[model samples]
Target: MSIRSVITTADEQVPFAAVKERIVQAMCAAGLGAVLLFGAGFSSMETLHNAAHDSRHSAGFPCH
Candidate 1:
């Protein structure tokens, strides 16, 4: 018995609609999360502020 690999036969076009749907979903989720965090709905004031502050420092963003 021989094993074979299935490769694209050049008949398939890029699935643009599917790609766009996934991209839009991801962006929406990120936007919702950002609103929750920045709007102080995700946690208390101190926790949110400290988390943002620490992340900024770690990422080398000016937070001073």
Candidate 2:
């Protein structure tokens, strides 16, 4: 393909690329949140469990 045509095609896909990047970032954030909120919150380690518990209480997220 011509250089201009290639550039045009790439430009047209910019929005899709942005949307895909956003989705990936959101998924990663969700996974991390789950690990911190559930995994660490319920951990056997007292420190981790307490920290998550305190965070939830501070955020007004009911734990009981």
TM-score of each: 0.43, 0.47
Tens-digit per-residue lDDT, 1-64, candidate 1: 3332345457766599988999999999999999976778757889878989999999999998
Of candidate 1, the 10-residue stretch with the lowest lDDT total is 1-10
For candidate 2, the 10 contiguous residues with the lowest summed lDDT are: 5-14
Model-by-model lDDT, in order? 0.83, 0.84
What is the TM-score of candidate 2?
0.47
* lDDT string, candidate 2, 1-64, tens digits: 7888656554365678889999999999999999878976566788877887999999999998
Query: For residue 35, what is the lDDT in candidate 2?
Result: 83
What alpha-carbon RMSD in Å does predicted model 2 have with respect to the real structure? 9.0
